[model samples]
Target chain A: MKKMLLLYVVVIGTLMAYLYMVYFREDNGGLSENAGLHGKTDERYVMVNFLTGIDYWKNSLKGFEDAAEALGVSVEYRGSTQYDVQEEVMVLEQVIARSPSGIAVSAINSEALNAAINKAVEAGIPVVMFDSDAPDSDAYSFLGTNNYNAGVTAAREMAELTGGQGEVGIISLPNQLNHQERTRGFSDTLAKEFPKLRLVGIEDGKGDQLVTEQKSLELMERYPGLTGIFVTEANGGVGAGNAVLQAEKIDKVHIISFDTDKGTLDMVKSGTISATLAQGTWNMGYWSLMHLFHLHNELAEPMPDWRSSDVPPLPTYVDTGITVVTESNVDQFYAK
Target chain B: MKKMLLLYVVVIGTLMAYLYMVYFREDNGGLSENAGLHGKTDERYVMVNFLTGIDYWKNSLKGFEDAAEALGVSVEYRGSTQYDVQEEVMVLEQVIARSPSGIAVSAINSEALNAAINKAVEAGIPVVMFDSDAPDSDAYSFLGTNNYNAGVTAAREMAELTGGQGEVGIISLPNQLNHQERTRGFSDTLAKEFPKLRLVGIEDGKGDQLVTEQKSLELMERYPGLTGIFVTEANGGVGAGNAVLQAEKIDKVHIISFDTDKGTLDMVKSGTISATLAQGTWNMGYWSLMHLFHLHNELAEPMPDWRSSDVPPLPTYVDTGITVVTESNVDQFYAK
Candidate 1:
C-alpha cells in the first residue's frame, strides 16, 4: 500500500513539474537559456519595398530570408507591384495592419512613408530601413550604400578616365535624396579636386530609361566637348548608353553610371556604357532583420533615461560598400 | 499474484516498444517520416577550384553554400591555394580519398586532371565540372559560359561599335581551349559578316595583363589605323584598355574585352574599354551541387543504354549564359 502510494505521488509530481516549466516558459518568452528547447516560432518579420520583382531587390531579400532562417523565425516579402511611391505607402499601411513582429522597408520616397513607418513603431513594432532610407522616421537603422560616397568614387573614377580635365555633366533624379546626394558628391568632388573638369549642368533623368536617353542626348548636344557624364541611377546609365550608341560617340565621350542592372551591365559589356558602381545589397537586408530581431527580442537595451523602452541601440546608418565593375571582372557580376 | 504478473508484463512490454521505436529511428538516417527530427548534419559535400581566394569564385561558392543549406546538408570549400594545375590534381586525389558523397570541380587545365577525375568516378563518387571544363573526362556534365558564342557576341558587338569598318586585332591566350574557341569565333564571325574589318593578327597575350598590354601596343604600332581590338580574356582586355589609354586614342581605338574583372570593369567605366562579357558563374556552382545531391540520394535516374549505373541523366553541357556590361548599367554589376 505504501509502495503504491509512493508511485502515485512520484508520477503526479513529475507531471506537475513539467507543466510548471512549460507555463513559465510561455509566460516569459524563450529569452532564457535554462528554458531549453524552443517551439515553432510565433515571430514573423516582413520586408517592404517598391517594384518587388526587380533584380535590385533580389540580393537584399536573400539576405533577409537568410537572417530569418538563422533566427528560426518566419519572414514575408511585401512591396508595391509597381514603382509608385503611393503604392509603397499603401503597402506599408497594409503591413502595419498585420502587426508583424518587425518590418524592414526600402522607401520609394524619403518622406512619403514616414507616417506609416512611425505608426508601426508607435504600435510597439520595430521598423528598419534599407536601400532607400526615410531620414525623419523613427526607425531603428538605415542600412544601405552611402550615396554621397558612391558619387565621390564616381567622380574620382571619372577623373581617371578623363585625365582630370574635361567638360562634365550629370544625369540624375533631382528629388530623391539618394540621387541628390550622389550628384552633390560628384559636383563637390570635381570642384574640390579636379578644378579643370567643368560641370556643364545637371539634368533630371526622372529615373526613366527613355527620358534619361533623351536628356543625355540633349546634354551631349548642348556640350559637344563633354568628356564625361555621371548617371546617378541604373536606368539613367542605360539611357545614357543608348544615347552614346545612337550618337556613335562610343570612344569619345566617357559615360559613368550607377548600379549593376542587366541593361546597364549589357551596355558596359558591349562598350556603349562605361563603368558602374555596385552596392552591397545583401548586407542591407541581413542587418535590417538583425536589428529588428534584437528590438523584438528586447535583447538590445534601450538608451538610459529614454522616453520609452522601445528604442534599439542600433546605429543610425550602415554604409554597405560598393564595387566597381568593368570589362575584366564584368563576368563575375552576372548571376552565377 | 498471476494477475499482478500479467499487469507488470503488459506495462513493461509497452514501454519497451516505445523505446524500441525511438532507438531504431535515432540509428537510421533521417529518411523516414516518423523520424522527422534532424540534428547537426552528417552529410558533407565539397567544392574544388583554383586561385581559391580570388573574387571570381565568390558567387559560385555562395551558390554551393546556398544549395547545401536548402538540402539540409553541410558543405566544405576546398581548392588549390594557387593557380597551379598539378596542385589541383593533388587536391582532387586527396578529396577522392576522403570518399565524400560527391564533388564539384572547376578544372584548371583541360586534360591534365582527367585521370584523377576518372578515378573518383571509378570509386563510385559523382563528379561535375563547372567554369572551365574537361570535356573528354568522365565527369557527368559541364556548366559554364559557351566560350565560342561569347566570342561571337563580342565580334558582333565590335562590328556595331566600329561600324563594320576598320582593322582589328586579337590579344588572347592561344593555349586555352576556351580562348582558342573565342578567337576562332571572332575570326570566323568577322570574316563572314564584316568583310572590311580586317584581322591584322592574333597575338597571344599569354593570359598576363602586362604581356597583353605589350602585345596591344605592338598591334597598335604595327597597324596605326587599327580602330578596334578584341581581347579574349579579362587581363588581356585591361591590357588593351591601358594601351588605348596610353595612346590617347580613347575616341578612335575601340576595345572589346572578354570577362568582367575589376581592372577591365574600371577601364570600361572610364570608357577605356568598350565592353565585357559576363558569365553565369552562380548557376555553375549551384547546379553542380544540386546535381550531385540528386545523384547521392538516387533521385536522378540513369539513361537506358548508358554503360554505367552511376550516370545522372543531365545534359552534357549547361551553357550558363552571358551578359554584356557597359557604362549604362556598369554600377549594377557592383556587389549590392
Candidate 2:
C-alpha cells in the first residue's frame, strides 16, 4: 500500500509539470510567445492620417495593421478627428515626438506638414504619406491614389456621361493636395481632350456633406442647363446626389463622385448618382505600411525623392488604380 | 568691424544649433535603438492562416504592424501558401518554437488547428483567431465575419432577386470554416424561410475561378432551368458569371457572389451577375488588429465566452456588415 501511494504521487507530479509547461509556462521565444507580444512596449510602427473616421481610411488602416502583424510589430493610428490643417499638423508633431519606428501620414496641408515631416526624416524616423501628400516633404515615400490621373479618369467619365457635349460643374476641396490635383487633372483633360464639354463652375465643397449639397444646389440654380457634376470626395458626391434627387432632375443631371461610402454607393444603385472613381484604397494602406516597415527596419534604401518613391519606380504618385463603378458592376463592391 | 564679424558668427552658430536640434537630432527615439528591441527578442507575435496570399490579409497585417510600430515590437505572418492543413500545422509548430508575443490565426481546419492552437495557449501565450476561427481553441478571441448571419442576409437578397420562387445552386469552398457556416446559414434559411426557392445542387469550386467556371457549367447542364446560383466567394462568382455568359443564359440565370474584387464587380456591371454579397473585409482586418492590440497590450480583458458575449458588451464576433450590390447601386461603389 505504501509503495502504491508513492508511485501515485510521482505520477501526479509529472502531470502537473507537463500542464504547467503547456499551459502556464512563459516561453517568450517560443511560438506561443508571439501572441504575447501585443501592447507590450515593443510596437514600432505608427500610421498617421487626417480624419481617420472616414470609410476611405478604414481599408488603408487595415493594410497598415496587416503589414504590421506580418512583420511582428505593433502600430498606432493617430490622426485629426476633423479635417483641420492645424489639427493634422499637431497630430503629426505628437507622433514625431514619440519617435516611433516609422510614421505613415496623410498630409492634410502640403505646406504645413513639410517642416515637421522633414524633422522626422532628419531624426531617422522614416515617413510615408498616403491618401493625400506633401510633395516637398523629406518623407521617404507617398502611397496613395494618383489624384491627377484619377481626376483625368473622372473627366473622361463625365464627358462620357454628357455624351462629350454639355456644360458640367465640379465641386471640390481646393486646398487639399489630392483634391487639388484631381481638380486640375479633370479640368485640364476636359479642356484639352473634350472640347465639346464645357466646365461652367468649380466650387469648393469644403469636404462637408451639407456644404457640398448646398453648393451643388446653388450650382444647379446658377447653371440651369448643367448636364453633369463631378464631386471629388465621398460626402460631396452623396450631397450632390441628394441635390439631384431632390430637384427631380435625375434625368437631366448626371453626377460622378469619388470613394465608396455606403450612402454614395446606395445612391449609385438607385441611379441618383451615375458613376464614381474607385481608388486602390487597399493598396494605399498595404504599401504605405510596407514601405514604412521597410524604411523603419532599414530594409530598403530611401529614394532620392521620397514623395515620388512611395509607389516606387512606378510613379511619384502611384495611381494604385482606379475603377469606374457603375450600376452594372456595383455588385462586385459588395462585402462578402 | 571685427566685433561685428564675431557677432555674425555667433548668431549663425546659434541658428544652426536650433535647426540641428529641431530637424536633425534623434528626437523621436532613434531607429537603431528600436531595431535592437526587435532583434533577438524573446517575445513574438505570429499570424497563422490558410492561403495567405489573398488581399484580405494585407489589411490585417497592416493593423498588426501599426501596433508593433507604436509599441516598439515585432510580429511575423506564417501560414499555408495553399489551403492545406498539414502546411498550416507545420507553420504553427515553427512559430511556437520561436516563442512569440501572441498568436493571431485564421484557422483553415477547426480540428486540425486545435492541437497546435491549444499548445500555443497552454504555453502561456494568448492566441486570437481572425478572418476564420477555431471555436474550440483556447484562443482569447475570434475577430472575423459573423458568416452564418451574413448567409441569412444573402438568402433574403436571393429571394428578392428570384421573386422568392426559383431554384438556386451554391458554389463554395468545401473545407473552409467560414464558407461552411455561410452555406449552412444559407441552406437552412432557404428551407425554412423561402419554401418556394428550391436549392437544386451544391458544387465545390475550391475557390478557384477555372474550377468554379467548370463546375458551374456542369451545374447548368444538369439543371437547365436553374434560375440563380449563389457563389460563396469572389472567384466562384466571376467563374459562374463566365459560365452563364458562355451558356447565353444571362436572362434566365442570376449570379450572386461574395466579395468586391474588380473582376467580380465588372461582371456585375455588365449585367452578367445579378448581385453580390460584399463582406466588410476592411472591417474584419481593422477590428482584428484592434482586438489583438488591446489583448496583447492587456488594455482590455478577454471575454469569458466569446460566443455568448460576442454580440453584446464587447462584441467579440462582429458582423462588420454586408451590403447587397447590384447594377442599381454600382455608381455609388465607384470611387471619385
Candidate 3:
C-alpha cells in the first residue's frame, strides 16, 4: 500500500510539471508564435528628430515615426528647448555622438549645421533633412513643404484679398532658408503675376512677436497707405495682429500670416487678419523619417533608386503641400 | 649591391606599413571614436497609431525617435492606411509577433483592443497608450490632451460667438472616447454656464464630409432657428460649412470645428465657420514617445523617485493644450 501511494505521488508531480511547462511557461514567453520572421541582429536602426514644444514640426515627426514603424525599427525626438541654432547644434552633436542608425533634421540655420551633419555621414550614419533644409549639408534628402510654391500661392491669395492692387509689406524671418524661400517666392510672384500690386517694404521680424510688432508698426508708420501685411511664423502673425489692433486699422490693414496657432486663427475670425497659409506639416515629418529608416535598414535604397517601378522609392525633395486658411472654412478647424 | 637594395626595400616597406596603420587604416576603419559608446546592442521599441496620414502625429514620432537615439536603441511606427480598427489590429498583431522591446499604441477603440493588448502585456512586453487611449487595456499610462477640458473651453467660446443665448447643434463622432468626453463637456457646460443657450440637437457626423453634410442638412431642417453648429473634426466642419453655404444660412448659422486643417480655416475666413479649437497635437505625439522610450530604456524609473529631488520623473498624463481659432487671430496662421 505504501509503495503504491508513493508511486501515485510521483506520477502526479511529473504531470503537474509537464502542465506548467506546456501552459504557463509558453504563454509567458516574450515572443509570441504569431510574430513575423526576425531580421539579422546587425541590421537594427533608430531614427531621431526634434519633436516637442513646436507645432510646426509635428507632421514631419509623424511621417518619420510611421516609416520607422512600418519597417519594424525605432525612432527618437531631440532638439533645443527654444528655437536657438546653437542649442540645436549641440543637440545634433549629442545625437551624432550616440551614433544613431540615422538622423533627420530640420535645420534652423542652413549654414550652422554643416560640420556636424558632415561628421555623422562621414561616420557611416545616414542623415536626412525635413521641414527646413540645409542645401549645402551632406544630408542625403530633403522632404518638406515646398516653401517657394507656398509663397506663390500666398501672393496670389493676397492679390485676391486686396483686389489685385495695393501696397503690401512683408514681415519675415530673413535668416532661415525656408522663410527666405517663401519671401523670394512672394516677391517674385508679386513682381510677375500681380502687376497692379506694389511690394513696398520688407521687414525682419526675427521670428519674434515683439520684433514683428515693432517692425509692423514701423512699416505702417513709414508706408501710411500700407494695404496689407504678410508675416511669417506664429509669433510674427500675432505681433502683426497686435499692431493692427493697437493702430485701430482692422478694416484698412489686411494681414496674412503663417501657421495655425490660436492667436492667428482668432484674428482671422474677427476680421483683423484676412487669411493664412497652412502647411502639410504631417507629411514632412512622416516622409522624412520613412526615408531615414529605409536608408538605415537597407529596406529602401537612397534616392536615384532609378528603377522604373509602380511606386517609385522616394524623391529627394518631396513637396508635401500647403493651403490657404480663411474664415469661410474656419469652423472646420474648431475642436468639438 | 643586391644586399643593399633588399635592405633598403625592407626599411621603406616597414615605414609605409607603419604610416598606413597610424593614419590611412585608422581613417578607413569605418568607425569613429563616438561609435564605441553608441554601438551597444539594445532591444527595439515601437509605437503605432491610427490615422497615420494626419499632420498632428509628427512631433510624437520625433520624441519616440529621439528617445531611441539617446538610448542607443531602435523604434518603429505602424498604422492602418485609413482610420479602420481592423487594419490597426492586424498591424498590432503583426508587430506583436515580432516581439519588440516595447510598444506604444494610440487606441482607436478602447474596448476592442483589450484582449490583444493584454496578450502583449502577458507576454512580458510593456505597453503604453498615447494621444487617444484605451483606459481598460493593460497600457501603463495615457499621455495626451485633456479632451474634456478642451470641450468646456469650446462651449464657452460658442456662447460668446452666439452672444450667450441661442440654439446650438453638435456634429460629433459619438463612438470615440475622446470625442465623447468633448461632447459631454460641451453639453455639460452649455447646461450649467450658459442658461439662455439651448442645445437643440446632437448629430453623428461619422467624421466624414458627406455624412456630416447630410447630418447638418437634417439638423438645419429640424432646427430652423439653429444659431450655431459645433463640429468635432476638420472634415466635419467642412461638410457643415458646405451645408450652410448650400442652404444660404451663413448669416443665421455659426460654425465651430476642430483641428487646423485648411478646409476649416478657409471657411472661417469666408464667414461660413465661426471658430475652431486647435489641440496641441504635436506635443501629444512627441511626449508620448518620449515617455515610452524613457520607460523602455530604464533611463528614468517608471515612477518618480521621491528621494532624488533634483530631476523628477515624467507624469503619466500630459495635457498638451487647446486653443480657440477664430477670425480675430486668423492672420497669424497664414503661411509666410
Candidate 4:
C-alpha cells in the first residue's frame, strides 16, 4: 500500500509538470533567448546606418537608445561608418546571423539592401527603416521625415528669400534617393508654384563641403545671374554658403540648406544661409524601436488570424516631420 | 573533557576564518566593487567629455570600449552633450557619487574643473585626462596630443603650402587653452622660421564655422595679399576654407586645418583645403582606460608604494601623437 501511494504521487507530479509545460509554451518563432530570472528577458536590438559617426545620426541614435532604456531592453549601435553600401550589407548579414530581436536601418542605396532585409524578415526578425528607407524591402515600417515635403518647404522658403523671381541652382548628391526626391520636389514645386523662379542648373556636391563649394562656384560662373542656391544636405549647404561668400554674393544670393548641424545653424544665424530644415531625427529613432519591440513581443501572444506578414496594431509608415529653422529660432536647435 | 574539546574546535575555526579574511582583503582605495565570482573583478570605468555627441569623441570612446572588452570590465560614456562647462561639472559630480572604479575626463576649460576633479581623486577614484586636460587638477595622467606641438606642425604645414612667402592670418578660439596653445605655436613658428610669411591678423572664430568664415573673410579683406590661413580647430578650418572659397581664393589661399573629421578630410582630398592634423585620438582613449584599470587594481596587489596619491609607476603624461593628412594620403583617414 505504501509503494502504491508512492507511485500515485510520482504520477501526479509528472502530470502537473506536463500540463504546465503545455499551457505555458509560447510561440517565439524559434528565436529569442530563454526568459531570464523572474520571467524577465534580456533581448537586444540594433540600429544600423552608414557614416555612423556623423552628427547627422546623433539625435536619432539617442532616441533609439532612450526607447530601449525605457523598455528595460538593450540596444547596440552598428553601421558601416562609411559611405559604402557593400559594407552596410555585410554588416546587416552578420547582424542577422546573430538573430537580434530587431534591426533599424538607414539604407545607403534604396534597392540594394532589399535582399538582405528580406532575409532578416524570413528569419523572423523584425526590421524597421529610419532616416533613409528601402521602400520595397520587407521592413515592418518606415519612420522618417517626408523628404519630398521637406524639399517643397525649402522651395517656398527660398522663394520668399529671393522674392520668387530669380535664377536658382541646386547643389546635391544626385545618386541618393532622398536627395533625388528632394531635388525633384524643389524643382517641381518651383516650376509649378513659383513660375518666375528659374532653376538654372543642378550640380552634384557629392555631400562634401569643398565639392559643394566647387560645384556652387561652377554654377555661379555658369549662370552669373543665379540669385539663390538650395543645398540638399548640410555639408553642401555650408559649401554653397561659402561659395556665395567667395563670390561676394552673400547678400544677393539666398541659400536654403537641409539639417541643423552646427555648421548649418551657424551659417543660418550669420545670414550666410537663409534657412534650414530640421528633421524630426529623434522621433524616427525612438518610434522605430518602440514599434519593433511591440512587433517582436507580439509573437508570444495569441490572437485569431494573426499572421507573420500582417503585423497589425502599428502603422507601416510614420512621417516624423520637419521644421524650418531660421536665424530667429536657430538658438533652439543648438546641442543641449 | 568534552566541553574543552568543543571549545578548542570553535577557537580554531574562528582563527582560520579571521586569517582568510585578513589576508584576502584587497586594497582598492575603497572604491572598486566587490570582486565577482571565480576571482574576477567587475570593475567599471567611465569617460567624461564635453560635446558628447560630436564625431570627435567617437573614435576615442571606441578605443576605451575595446580596452574594457579585452580586460573583461565595463566602460560608461558621460559628458555635456553641449559645449557647456557647468554641464560637464554636473555630470562629473554625479559620476563621482556612483563611486566608479575609475574616471577619465576631457576638460572643457583648463582651470574651471580643477576643484571637481580634485574631489574625485580625493574620494579615492582614479582620474585621468584625455584629448584635453586640467593641468592644475589631481588627474593622475594626461594622455593626448601635445596641443602646442600640433600647432607648430600646423604652422610649418601652412608655410609649406604657401611656398614660405605670403601674408597669412589665424582664426582660433582664443579662450580655449588648447586653441590658445595652437595659435601661439603657429604664430611663434611663423615669426621664428617663416620670415617672409607675415602674420597679418588673429581673429577669434569662437570655433563656429560661420564665425570662422566671417573672421576669415575679414582677415582676407583686411589683408588682400593673404595667401594662407591657419585654422586651429576643425569646424573653424572648414569655415575658413569656405571663406577662402567664397572669396574665390580656393587656388590662391592655402588652408591648414586641424583634425581628420570627414569635413576636413573631404576638403583635403578635393584640394579645397591644403591639409589637416590627425590626432592619435584612439590611443588617447585606449591607454587612459588601460592605465586607470591598472591604477584601480594595483591597490589590491602587494605593492608597498601603492597609495591614493602615488598612483604607482605609470607615467603621468602620455603624448598621444598626431599625423598630417594631405591629398597624398587622405584616403587613409576616411571612416573604415
C-alpha lDDT values of all predictions: 0.77, 0.72, 0.71, 0.78
Ranking by lDDT: 4, 1, 2, 3
Write one digit per residue (lDDT tens) for candidate 4, span A151-204.
898899989988998899998889877898899999999999999999998888
| Lowest summed lDDT window (length 10), candidate 4 chain B | B29-38
TM-scores for candidates 1 onward, in order: 0.49, 0.44, 0.43, 0.45
Candidate with top TM-score is: 1
Q: Alpha-carbon error at A289 in model 2, in Å? A: 1.3
Over B1-336, each residue of candidate 2 has an lDDT whose tens digit, in order, gives: 566556556655655565465443343223323322132334456678878898656655765665454444567878899979899999998988887777888888777888988898677656777777787776765666667877897888889888888789999987877888889989999999999999998889998999999998998899887888889987788899999999999998888899777788788899999988765444444345544554444433222432332211122333344667888765444322
Model 2 chain B worst lDDT run, 10 consecutive residues: B306-315
Which structure is stronger by lDDT: 3 or 4?
4
Candidate 4 residues B177-255, lDDT tens each?
Answer: 8888988988899999999999988888887899998998898888889899888888887888788889999988998
Candidate 2 ranges with C-alpha deviation above 4 Å: A1-43, A302-317, A331-336, B1-336
- Model 2: per-residue lDDT, tens digit, A292-323? 66555433322244333322211123334566
Please, what are the lDDT tens digits per residue for candidate 3 over residues B1-336? 566556556655655565565465345322222122121246677788888988666656765665445345667888887979888898998898998877889887887777888888677666778777787776655666667777898899989888988799999988777888888889999999998889988889988999999999999999888888889876899999999999999888888899777788887777788888766554454445544554454433222331222112223344455667788765544332
| Model 4 spans > 4 angstroms off | A1-336, B1-41, B299-305, B308-312
lDDT, model 2, position B323: 63
| Candidate 1 root-mean-square deviation in Å | 20.1
